[model samples]
Target chain A: MATARAYTNIALIKYWGKQDPQQMLPYNSSLSLTLDQFYTETKVEFLPKQTNQTADSFVFAGVAQPVSPKITRMLNLIRQAAGWSNFARVETENHVPTSAGLASSASAFAALAAAGAQAAGLQLSPRELSIFARHGSGSACRSIFGGFVVWHAGHDDQSSYAEPLLATVDFPIVVIAVLVDQRPKKVLSSAGMQQSVATSPFYPAWVQTAESGIATMSQAIAAHDIARIGQLAEANAMQMHATTLSAVPPFTYFAPMTLKIWQLVQEFRTKGLSCYITLDAGPNPKLLCAKQDAAAVVKKLQAALPQLQCTICQPGPGVAYRD
Target chain B: MATARAYTNIALIKYWGKQDPQQMLPYNSSLSLTLDQFYTETKVEFLPKQTNQTADSFVFAGVAQPVSPKITRMLNLIRQAAGWSNFARVETENHVPTSAGLASSASAFAALAAAGAQAAGLQLSPRELSIFARHGSGSACRSIFGGFVVWHAGHDDQSSYAEPLLATVDFPIVVIAVLVDQRPKKVLSSAGMQQSVATSPFYPAWVQTAESGIATMSQAIAAHDIARIGQLAEANAMQMHATTLSAVPPFTYFAPMTLKIWQLVQEFRTKGLSCYITLDAGPNPKLLCAKQDAAAVVKKLQAALPQLQCTICQPGPGVAYRD
Candidate 1:
């Protein structure tokens, strides 16, 4: 048996739509940072098959759950790659809330891919593991590496994978995630992206901006220009949400509190503190700032919104295996 | 003394950013329908000057108010064009609330332009009147014409003017204005436009889309396809909001109730009603539908949002002298 752990990542630059729906090819490249606070651990064991027995079983949160089609498909890929015919039993533990604004799938799938491959007697490089994890969830590909990571929109499945943008190093970065709502959105990211790609006239512009923005983002990261990176990241997220609003039968991930937080970030900047905000396909708002200002920023935010719950996070390590 | 009345208009294709700040030339052509419910009546008189007296006095809502800078600038333009040195006394009555998500400027400025020109003994055509109004506010140019109107984005001030797309006649359309809030936004339209034009990466795409959409919108209006027109208008307004969100230090006019109404409109459609929504730079939402279904739509909307104050409006006449 092999067990592995992976941390969730927040995409500074967003991936809004897919270029190829079936293969999950993204419309553009994206950059992200894996958070230290949230993660998932998974253990996979190959069991000898009995006559007329279930081929695979997935146990989640200590409850035996039926294998979803997506999970089944991902397991089939691993089985085919490892050249193993034995049935497998998978047990997963999620440290973060599922289907909330948090990126639970990114950590869950990355851990599963790592644990499953090793348990099947297969040794794969991180890049190969990333490709496998992507077969489960697109953003999961980025969870293979920690620190600053970039997922390239390679033309085909063979070429598409994520790698660290820079060596694992401590940067003066901090993210305070403000959880406004933990409920699952009525429109999932998968359905939202499909609708945007099919209907929004400005969707093409978003793809172009996101694809081209990666180079500038990398430069900003290398120079450690926090302001430039934050601005670009904020704009990238806004562009993604823009596609949703412009889509036919428009929708927005913003709960009213989202705008209130957005305005407060600007107010914070006017007070001479450097801070910016980024949102994903959910109503929660995340503030990106320097580590030195994290405490003060959190205090100010708490004073302004007394009921809000915020988590302070920094960079974490890549997916790793345990004994 | 001369008095003129002009109704306010709601842009189906929004005019957010400006191309020429001084001349108020828009970045994109826009289309709008003048509403019958809300308007402004202004009377201008070139009074004889008294020693040591102020050059101009403005009376608004039956109260004597100091002449604002914008009002001063507009009066200067009228004086320069008509070659009058006498001081002017202006009295204005607004049927609609000012700076409260209603296009009060559109009617106020258009009526001022007409009455100002005639009071100064200047005989200008409707096109010239639109050009004069453009100096006051960009959208004001469109209010000089009735029914379906298009504000062409010409290369220069003289060429840029609004004209009736078709002769004044009733169309099968009704606008239900839902007033969610009457409070002024923290960010004014002018500052929002400037910030968006300078910072938003998606602003260029908005300009391109708005320019291209006018042709399709005109075609739909010609065919009297209420559904098509409503869809295009709704998309246009959403695109404008997208630019604001993508701007550096992003901002939004949406209150929580604004989104609630937006979702309710889609719910209305799922029930086999042909209704769409358009929003300006405020928290209010306007629903576009056929007049025949107006009563049923209002009933449903009131049921969902009991506190909402809705006004049913249809097309009205263009700016003209009041007896």
Candidate 2:
């Protein structure tokens, strides 16, 4: 048995559309920061043929679940890669909230990739593991690395992988994720992205912009320019949402309170406190600011929007295996 | 005294950012549909020197208001254009709701341009009137002509003017303006545009996309393709709003109900009933559909959102003189 854990990652530059949907390949490169506060742990045990297990069994959060098509497919990919014909039993525990714009899939798939490969007696590098993990979820590749990580949008399966930056950002950066809604969104990211790529007139430009943003963001991270990095992240997320709005029969992830929180961030800037806001395909707003100011900022935000719950996080470690 | 009435025009391809702020010249050309439901009537009377009036006096909605800087500036621009130095008394009545996402400024300034020029004893052609009107508000140029009007974004103030499309679309298209809120928006269009132009990283691409959209929309108009025209209009408005979201300290005009109306339009399409949704810088949604379906669409929308008030409108005439 091999158990592994992977932390969730919040994208600084967003990944919206897929160049290859079947393979889960992204149209543009993206950067993300792995969070210390939340993660997923998975244990995988390969069952011998003598056990007469016809299919893999899955358990989530201590509850036995019927093997979903997605989980079955992910397990099959691992079996093929490791040359293991035996079936497996997998158990996963989620430390982060699932399906709430928290990128739970990132940690879930990363941990699965790591533990499943190890349990199958395969020794693979992080890059190889990332390629395997990406088959589960496009963003899972980034969860293989800690600190600032960039997912290169390569043309083929082998070339597309994530690698950690040479320069670890020295400044204390705080990411305050304001949980506005915990319910699964009506429009799934996969469905929403497919619609955007097919219909949005502005989509082609978005790909080009995100590609260039990767290079700019790399330099900002290297230089430890928190303000520049935060600004780039904020703009990138907004542009991503823009494509959604521009899609034929447009849609938006924004609720009324989403805009209200954005307004609060702007108000903070006006008072000489510089912070940036980014949101995924959900109503929650994540504020990036100096680590020292996290408490004060959260205080102000809670006072203004009393119902909001903020989770403070910093850079976390990459995927690790346990004996 | 000379009075002119001009109906409001909603841009199918929006004009957002300006190349020249003082001249009110848009970065890209735009097309608009003049609506018959709402209008503004303005009477301009030049006060003689014997009357001892040093400044222009303004009245709106039967209430006398101090000459605001915006009004003063608009009057000054007209004075420079007509070569008239006399102060004027401007009485304006808004048949449309003011500053509520209903292009009230478009009709107001278009009326002022026509009546103000006439009261100064200046005879200007429609093309010349469009040029004068653009100085007051960028979108006002399109309101000079009825039906389908295209405002050519020219390099100089004299070159930019609106011209009626040669192809008069005889299709029975109905525009239903959904009034979600009657109260004035907190962010005025003028200030919002300035901020977006100054800060949004996506503004340059927006200019490029909007420029091409104008040509594509013109062809759709020429072909009398209702579906194509409505699709182009919907995408254009959303792209314009996207720029606002990417603006530094980002803002959105959308309320929660605004998105609800948009979803309803998409639902209409899925049901084999085609309808398109567009919005300006406010929460109100404008639905474009076949005239035969207007009553049914409104009925369904009111059923879904009881608080919504839908105003039905059709193609209106150009700026007209009133004795």
Name the top DockQ candidate. 1
Q: Clashing pairs in model 1?
A: none
Best by lDDT: 1
lDDT of 1 by residue, A133-166 (tens): 8888899989999999999989999788999997
| Interface C-alpha RMSD, model 2 | 2.6
lDDT of all predictions: 0.86, 0.85
Consecutive 10-residue window with the lowest summed lDDT within model 2 chain A: A96-105
Model 1 CA deviation exceeding 4 Å by range: A49-54, A97-100, A167-169, A223-228, A271-274, A295-307, B48-54, B66-73, B76-83, B97-100, B166-169, B292-307
Off by over 4 Å in 2: A62-81, A97-101, A166-171, A215-228, A268-275, A296-309, B47-51, B61-84, B97-101, B166-171, B180-187, B198-201, B215-228, B268-274, B295-310
Cα lDDT tens digits for candidate 2, A182-217: 888888899999998998767887898889999999
Task: For residues B17-50, write the lDDT of model 2, one tens digit per residue.
Answer: 7889888788889889988888999999988878
Residue B198, model 1, lDDT: 92
